[model samples]
Target: MTTNNGRAFTAPQLEGAVWKKSSYSGDSQGQCVEVAALTFAPFAGMRAIRDSKNPDGPALVFPESSITGFLADLADGKFGN
Candidate 1:
């Protein structure tokens, strides 16, 4: 996979991946995000995020630490409304 802006990436293939959306993803239907864990070699322990509206589109891969920090910050309200 190729990295983009240190947070997003483009994988050549992602077969067998099981994508899941957040529980907070309401019934907006067309607007939501999905995440999948890459447990294969070279990408093991990494997390992949994408727009649920486009499952076949590219995904943004991030290290597990990055995902943790992002969620922590979100919970702490670091990103003001």
Candidate 2:
């Protein structure tokens, strides 16, 4: 099992995992990110993120709590323009 602390995963480690982009991701063909929920043991409740343009590339894994905090900060505009 991979650690849920932004560890990068190899191609073989992501086999069979389904990835989906954000709903707000427009069809501008610009930069977009994809996330896959880990539902199996040892990785369940976690999320794997990657660049939509690089399907076979590495993915950053994070725990569910971390994702929640990130979303909260995003909603709060913590990373301002």
Candidate 3:
């Protein structure tokens, strides 16, 4: 029952999903993105990301594990801030 395929899902498909923005974004005029963990069937264990300023816009969905690795890389400064 695993759905870790590498694909992106649309934001419209994520209706009712509870999206959250990072606290670090903090009043940056909506320049940050928001993330949500899909809890429902067919999409559970997946993560969705979207622009805070364009909630109605498209979203990039990924497997939870992928998002986890991405966060880890971010913490490791792999992208070099």
Candidate 4:
């Protein structure tokens, strides 16, 4: 399925999966998101993040390479806050 951002990744049935709020999330209108990895489904890749409030909504899945680049830029403070 596709998310609002056009991300076509499978959304896991996280009825019992553990979810974690981002460290960046704060008391700013609850924009916090959560993520959890699956065990049996391997095609979903290594990482998955989704809106914490909407458990059945869309999720954005990124490839390892793309995530690396994004994290590198983030570490360098390349993105504007």
Candidate 5:
């Protein structure tokens, strides 16, 4: 995922995306992040969430199916946090 200027961080390469820390991620050692899908590229409909501190770091892109499932699980409290 590393590019010459920096890592291109393409949508497909974000499965292992590293996230930045958040105050809400307290004691998580920066294990969480805040990401949004950039609207200017073909990456639309694709997610690009990443750690806020490392703006250039990897991102997390979840497919529609996967994201939907995750949301359903959230509603059902599958992981129990």
Candidate 6:
């Protein structure tokens, strides 16, 4: 069976995760995002992303490798602005 690691997790499911936002989000009105590192079972080494404005909302979880690669691509401007 193929395991799906990327999934949208509920607030309660991520209660143990520590969320953090970007430093460049200052003065941005409702345009900030937060990321948390998951350390529990079935979520270890995973990353969770969510809107900073909605702390109680669902969060998208991804593997550490995926998040790292995505950040690298982002830094390389893979997704043109």
lDDT of 2: 0.85
Per-residue lDDT of candidate 1, residues 1-81 (tens digit):
444334655545666667899888888786889988888766678888888988877888888889899999999999997
In order of lDDT, best first, we have 6, 2, 3, 1, 4, 5
Best TM-score among the predictions, by candidate number: 6
Residue-level lDDT of model 4, residues 1-81, one tens digit each, is 332232545354434455677788875658778766533344244445788777678666555556668789999999878
The C-alpha TM-scores of every prediction are 0.81, 0.85, 0.81, 0.60, 0.50, 0.86
Q: Which tens-of-lDDT digit does each residue in 1-81 have in candidate 6?
A: 222556777899788899899998986765899999889887887889999999899898888999999999999999999
Evaluated at residue 26, the lDDT of candidate 5 is 71
Report clash pairs, candidate 5.
3-7, 20-51, 35-49
Residue 64 in candidate 2, Cα distance off native in Å: 0.6
lDDT (CA) for every model shown? 0.78, 0.85, 0.81, 0.60, 0.54, 0.85
Pick out the ten consecutive residues of candidate 6 with the lowest summed lDDT: 1-10
Q: What is the lDDT for 2 in model 2?
A: 43
Off by over 4 Å in 3: 1-8
Model 4 segments more than 4 A misplaced: 1-6, 9-17, 26-29
Q: Cα-based RMSD of the predictions, in order?
A: 2.3, 1.6, 2.7, 4.1, 7.8, 2.3
lDDT of 3 by residue, 1-81 (tens): 434454555666678899999899987675898999989877888888888998888777788888899889999999997
- In the range 1-81, model 2's lDDT, one tens digit per residue, is 649499998656877778899888888777899999988766778888999988889998899899999999999999996
With a 3 Å backbone cut-off (N, CA, C), the pairs that clash in candidate 1 are none
Pairs clashing within candidate 3: none
